[model samples]
Target chain A: MSRAYNFCAGPATLPEQVLLQARDEMLDWRGTGMSVMEMSHRSDEFVEIAETAEQDVRDLAGISDDYAVLFMQGGASSQFATVPLNLLGNSASADYVNTGIWSEKAIAEARRYGDVNVVASSAGCGFTTVPDQTGWKTRADAAYLHYTPNETIGGLEFDFVPDSGKVPLVADMSSSMLSCPVDVSKFGLIYAGAQKNIGPSGLVVVIVRKDLLGKAHVKIPTMMNYQVMADNASMFNTPATYSWYLTGLVFKWLKDQGGVSAIGELNARKAKKLYHFIDTNPLYSNPIDPRFRSRMNVPFILADEALNSAFLKGADERQLLNLKGHRSVGGMRASIYNAMPEAGVDALIFYMAEFAKERG
Target chain B: MSRAYNFCAGPATLPEQVLLQARDEMLDWRGTGMSVMEMSHRSDEFVEIAETAEQDVRDLAGISDDYAVLFMQGGASSQFATVPLNLLGNSASADYVNTGIWSEKAIAEARRYGDVNVVASSAGCGFTTVPDQTGWKTRADAAYLHYTPNETIGGLEFDFVPDSGKVPLVADMSSSMLSCPVDVSKFGLIYAGAQKNIGPSGLVVVIVRKDLLGKAHVKIPTMMNYQVMADNASMFNTPATYSWYLTGLVFKWLKDQGGVSAIGELNARKAKKLYHFIDTNPLYSNPIDPRFRSRMNVPFILADEALNSAFLKGADERQLLNLKGHRSVGGMRASIYNAMPEAGVDALIFYMAEFAKERG
Candidate 1:
């Protein structure tokens, strides 16, 4: 019956209330006599659940009718190819900004389809900072400009949205969607794998500007076609029904917590507290530039790298689980996404301070 | 909580025991203090879960290590493209047998990736029967010969596996996988969307012979590339972890019910009972050829079409749910998946007979 503070990034922590609600309704949703997972995607009840989840995203983020909200499957990794396959239309090239591992992945996938212009990259700086937009080399005839708003593994984020002028701005916001509100009209497309700020690992929420719908490559896989997905309302296939239902519950839970604006403020405060502690503590160090540090994923290294395992073992004992950093990065990471409470942040800070005092 | 008999074709029905166990583990899975959905894919806990699920599928289906089992996403629709993109290799064409809607859809997606020579089709016969394999005009030079063992929509199932000689035989077992045992060594690949006979939607299990690995078209999306999935043990990206976990639970439940052989006997008996009643009853008829009718999905029509609504309403009243057939093939479809209990089938039969007596 006890729940720990789970800090795993992507398939990350979900609101406890949402889990309890899902648990309560897992056997039979309301009086429907079946679980939401058991309901057909085309059934009136499931359609309502699906539509309500989409509408909630729109309401929470102020998304207009001009954009098509698609509940897609295959996570953000699928969208890596989907973006180029759908957006690259007749254009021979697309513009990309490399922030970290996720952006690099997007670039690699896009290369399979068309020419990619790396307009900006933080690779030179060890993915510690977002390159200044002023020094960028954006393509004039690029199909779309793609960027990762929040790099989950690198603990890097864009402090300001890049203005692409008339060119459409496409963002992979897998780790940051709904942590704050963004002006939906500014982007041609926005996609997030639901595992982090949304729901589970399989479902992804894609918001594409209506005008950008049908420009898919001729050879685009039907399941990967944005236009087809929008036309069919994201039920191009059976959809990840249970994941979508859980996402709806999350959207409802987010609304109950005063929508994105309130949650954003809370997220900002949580990230700031953790970063401020890291900055002041003698035994902990975060390498990212303060201005571009991510509010969702916060990676830090102990003053002594040799003590990493003991530190993590201690964290696990305290039930502050999944503090181990990604294998690519050798330190510890605490991904305090929207579901991660400020209390969890305080607990993390408490553990960090205690670990520092003992190991310093 | 009262549970109804759900006859939904896919996302159809799940074993009650699986749901109960999932509910109990919703908050804290095996004292891990987080739900399986919250666990990182790379974590020891979730990896164990993922591995265990894959192992169970191999055990239940009697698959040898010669086949690389991939837990993938985007459902069977995605696989429609994935199959051709990965398997087509240097071949100019792939041979396909279209028996029903799902087969036709698969053929359609494969056409985008390569030339799909429909070796045979039952469309002229109104998709009521499987085209005899003896008369199939399969290509000798084809990369693979594909067929649907059971079509969820038209209730048509191949009575025997198509012999493609040296051409690797591929089957979409979406609705029939684990409903019976099949000789895994006979086919190059077998795939099934977890929703029907496995678990929830959004997860597709692919069993590809190891030789089929590394043959994906260069343009194939990384997520859709079977080789990449197998190489990474299906963790090329964060998979549909929750769905995979649920599928594992179903596999365990299947084992407890005495494996595929025992369930195959039950499934056959259930289908025979329903088909026999329809044959003898004055008010019911199934258009599909009885010899090739699906054991997984039983589609029947009332002798008087006017009584369809009344029949469904009464069935709903009796806690028999989702009996409505696919919109494309309107009548009634009671999908008796492995999870659909014998008692539920009996209840359905009793209801059908009573309705016929009252209205015929």
Candidate 2:
């Protein structure tokens, strides 16, 4: 089966090994005489699938017993509201550090729930830099510090984890999760939409400190209640079973690849190679600060605007795919998540060189 | 490949044809050079998949332009909260008809958002029947009247639609949707989790009257706001792409089987044959009121209590899978959804006869 280097910034590329296993098991998972899709969520087989997946995720993250890992739906976009709904306790204000488009979106959604203070914002800089922690104006009365460490849209990320002091550090890790190792204890809650490094779309894995539970707003919707989700092990209702199963396969695959630390090193290498190629090439440019360039989603632009569409077409013809940048930020972005192999990045680098020689 | 007669209630059985098609396309869908799972939600190809699925669903339900078909995540359990969050509008109270377990869950969730008036409930009768509409005490000022048309747990169903006067009628059709022809004009809204008759677990299809667009509570989560979802065609966020595509395939299969009407006839025949066997056999019985018995989910009991475990074991050995009843109403259930072929039902009947002869 032929495959392409898909960089669609999610609902994106998954490991081929995971996909093949999923295809093989789509009809009947492990001789259970029923497809994972066809099994009852409450059955022993399904329960094992869910528990094993959660455990492996915990293992990969090195999570402790003080947290609850919830397998939920509606993506991280939903989590923008869910975070404020389930946390915030009685606080009127929450701190937000905006690095790029995703953080802006998260901040807007949080505003609907309560007072969201823009503690630090680099939006004025065209989202090319992460505001230094020293400049952050975090509120003492804030419920938490919410930030997007990696913004999938702007090709920017924070170089260091923020220090929130006594306040909880909550993060929307949709684009960067599992692209590297994360400190579980550093955040009150961390949620990632699974389409990136986890599994598929429609599933979001929320890792929240256990103490943060039961603080949901009085009017919070039942499904958004973290405590309810926690108590039921993310089985408050029937979960996205097939997606969860696929996640289990991915978790297993990650473990086989020597877990997150090993994957992180490989990811770093890919980012270094791709960024190095762009940095030296006068024909292409990545304007983000080198320290702030996202290792996961890399957005670069052509020196000549006339060659933009042609660049994409040529890349597609060379089997380098989904290199188009998000419409919100016009240019090209290659989101090399955990699933994107080094070979794929090498191919992209090769294509860039060939395209530049032919058109420059 | 080697298929089994899977009888799971939801996250339940899908057509063999559908599964095969999904497997074949899992790696690369329609020569797009990317699996449907890998494509961007914004890609022209993925957009077409989402739109075509929605259009075919609209056609299957005979939905008019006045209605908006929304593809969402978080399933029907999420919709229990979403329905009220979006529809409570200016009204402080809503009417609900409680028929079984699902209705009770819906009532409990809606109460968290607004005052829910349970117009009628059959929970007192051990949830084996549906309360008559004449006895329903629906309020004139109720923003909407909500009810479950099919209680998958008790195998009970509402035989007729409730008349809510001018109040918008809403129904949770999770277990009943697309099982038979539906009059889309009869209700202001209908939502169903895709697992049963539609597709996989994470996706939900919401058919709402166009007028229900902007009535969401000001505090409604962005993902749950019907107006936003309709305005964006359920693309306000990245949707459950793979599930949506599978649902599209299922819709095609349903249409090929002569649409819902033809499927309805076949479903009725399957229900009739299985129920007839239970009614005639002294060794088995179904206690639900005949008029209220659901055509999709059939719950029954062996006359000899001691043989329950053995019956399940023997059924599994015979390849009649997932026949065990819901834990809440345990004995046995043989859910025959649209994907369940009549031959599978015949195999089940044959197994039942053989087992009965041996044990009786």
- For this target, which candidate reaches the highest DockQ against the unseen true structure? 1
Specify the highest-lDDT model's number. 1
Score candidate 1 by DockQ.
Answer: 0.79
What tens-digit string does per-residue lDDT give for candidate 2 at A105-131? Answer: 899999998899998889798888888
Model 2 chain B — which ten-residue stretch has the worst lDDT? B26-35
**C-alpha lDDT of all candidate models, in order:** 0.93, 0.90
- How far off is model 1, as Cα RMSD? 1.0
Write candidate 2's Cα lDDT for B1-360 as tens digits.
267888889888999889888988888887666788888999989999888888888888899999999999988999999999999999999999888889999999999888999899887889888887788888999999998999998999888887888999999999999999878899999999999998999899999999988988999999999999989989899999988999999999999999999999999999999999999888899989999899999999999989999999998887888988888878999889999999999999999988899996
Identify the runs in model 2 with alpha carbons over 4 angstroms from their true place. none
Query: Which portions of model 1 miss their true places by more than 4 Å?
Result: none
lDDT of 1 at B299: 93
Residue A128: error of model 1 in Å?
1.5
Candidate 2 clashing pairs? none
